[model samples]
Target: MIQRKIPSAEEAEKLKALGLAVINKEAEAVAALAGRINGNFAQACCHMLACEGRIVVTGMGKSGHIGGKIAATLASTGSPAFFVHPGEANHGDLGMITGKDVVLAMSNSGETAELLTILPIIKRLGVPLIALTGNPASNLAREADVHIDISVAHEACPLNLAPTSSTTATLAMGDALAVALLEARGFTELDFARSHPGGSLGRRLLLHISDIMHTGSEVPVVREQAQLRDALIEMTNKGLGMTAVVDARGRLTGIYTDGDLRRTLDREIDIHGCRVRDVMHTGCKTATPDMLAAQALQIMQENKINALLIVDRQQRLTGAINMHDLLRAGVV
Candidate 1:
């Protein structure tokens, strides 16, 4: 075995410089691609927008990884897309493609054998093809209806053989396509949230107060004329640390909470005979059941209140929500 020499700090720094140089070179390549985004890019976007079927993304090896991510970004940003591994496409996954679908293929050399093997099938199926590759003269680009040139000056790799800069260029191109489609389709944050229902954005956008608020008889409520002891019992039963004090007509009068109880006790007020109206807080912050949980959180934070009484336009109590509700709904 030959003895290997360990790199010194200076050598490591040189490697770091080279790595950064690679990124800069690749970034320039990406910038060049952006400059070329004119009619062809617009046409590609129009093709995808008019597509009745899904966008099928395919690649092999490193390109496959980038393709998968591109598909996910497209799907979440208003375009319907999914990745089909080229190796698997020949085996059976080709069934997922149809005449109405569009194929976006990625390859640095533009001659990935596995990808080339599926190009003819995709063409036979009459699927429009968009190729992303470094070589504009390569077979994949030649056969493609729209070829996105992602050519780079050099690889970040010292040996100039690795897929570093090429992959970065491909990923950036994917982002451009996804974002362009996103803008052209007028895809809103709410629409994106629907595609990511399990994410935090989904919770913030889709969760309504009615979905998480304590409703019906579960809402802690007491008459304003009721004694503090009765209000305390209601708060205890509901376990919300607060209770709504309403009038005889079931309209909101005030709110009684553990904080109110603390202040009342500090003042040595008699809990047994004191009317809830005497100690309850008036003009407490409130929310509607249809409000977003994120809005409710903002209300709570602004007012420094942990609970809110949900009411209708008539001021009649409809439900109640607390910080715990927001927390449980992942809105906090």
Candidate 2:
């Protein structure tokens, strides 16, 4: 069901220019928000922070899409929030709104019938309403305890009928509110990670070296005094591209990696006769059990090495971590 119409060089250039103009228009609309961040904006943040319950976001059509995204950002950052379609509120969703909850209504014209219809239901509960709209004199904005000016000079659409610039302005205002509340609540990166547990962000913040490191029998370890052949056998058996070389007391001495073995091969050394201590890298990189996996990655990157060892305060070898393990754990 797809058809292709290839454009000539000039036609393609014109299309690119048109896209850039739309971006520039929207960017200008967002930039103008600096002047509109007035006292009412601060009041809006205070209202949400003081709420004992959640922030209920309601909007219609294109405004509803932006509201959904705003609600998600607020929930993940720190504030409790969710989007309720304005059209659904009158049916049965009105039961979800309570006195403790605060309502954030979005409408470019500030005259959405579906949203206005729910005003009485919210009013009976005495819930505070904050409006993000273009017209301050409109009913939704007038009824709101705090009115945010999301007015835009024009839409990005060539015909000026679409909701491009206004939606962008509303989204920016929502982000500003979320960030202000996040700072007020002193929400940390760890809190954000807990809310977003399924993504790479969660892996980077919560994962520790102990969580993904190869431990116990999986550790490729050999004594420094052991023959280089023994070290090579351990490395080959474990297949970590490296082996930790320790002393008899299990204290780390050095590391023997594929790179180290390659350098020794040029000398035509006897693997069986040479001690691991003779060729092992004494100044190799190591990580601790308590360090974040991301921090371990930094060490490997900064030192320009793939394999890292974990040791205690006494330098006893406890675990081994390689770039591959980090990749598998989604920490890389």
Candidate 3:
């Protein structure tokens, strides 16, 4: 093997120019395709919406990589889809194609031998073909039921050999298709959360305060007439750092926390015999069981409180929430 000489600054500048050229060319292609969104695009979206089976995406080489990404985006955004490599299709992957499935085949030149090899078989299976190609007259485009013209004047590569501009155009078109179908299908945030239940959005959208709040006997509560010592015991036993002071009707009257206890102790108040109502803070902050955990976190931060009593419209104690509960629920 022999060593090659490095290019001078002028040569490097020429190479950089080629990269910028590719970006510019692809940008123009995307703009042109966006302008061409008319009846054909609408028809493509309508066909996909009416599809009963998953969309089968197929491509070769760089197109295959983009195809896989497009399939993933479709699957995550309410449309059922998956990628099947053209090369694999010839070797029994063809069984993945069903008559009800819609096929999205990508090819810059519209004549990839591997992809073309299975085109006839896909047609025989009666699967509707949607072609993304640079040449509308190419075999793939001509045979497709709907042709999305992704033709670009030239690639950004100086050698014009690498698939740069064409691949970018294809990816943008894939995004456009996915978003169009997403809107047409009226996909809601809750629907998206269901598909991504393992993510943070799912946690926020699906979690409710009642799902995590301490309820029943675990709730720290004492009557307004209860002694301060009894309230302290309730707080310590519940471990929620706060206790609700309610009336005989179980209606929330006030609240006592460790902070209030410290303030009372500093004043030398008699905890053993003093009523909880005398030492507790009146009109304490509260939340409802139906409130979102995220909203509860906001309330705690705004009021600088560590815990909140869950109450009904009648001010009766229903449950309780703490900062730790919000943290565990990912609301913070």
Best by lDDT: 2
Number of backbone collisions per candidate, in order?
0, 0, 1
Model 2 ranges off by over 4 Å: 1-3, 266-269
TM-score of 3: 0.82
Q: What TM-score, over all chains together, does every model reach?
A: 0.88, 0.92, 0.82
Instruction: Give one digit per residue, the lDDT tens place, for model 2 in 1-332.
Output: 89899999999999999999999999999999999899999999989999999999999999999999999999999999999998888899988888899999999999999999989889889999999999999999999999999999999999999999999999999999999999999999899999998999899999999999999999999987889999999999999999999989999989999999999999899878999999999978898999999999999999899989999999999999999999999988
Best model per TM-score: 2
Q: Model 3 Cα displacement at 69 (Å)?
A: 1.3
Ranking by lDDT: 2, 1, 3
**What's the lDDT for all of these models?**
0.91, 0.94, 0.90
Q: Tens digits of per-residue lDDT for model 3 on 192-286?
A: 98898888888877777899999999999999888889999999999999999999999999999999999999999988989999999998999
Indicate the worst ten consecutive residues by lDDT in candidate 2: 90-99
Choose 1 or 2, whichever is better by lDDT: 2
**Candidate 2, after superposition: displacement of residue 126 in Å?**
1.8
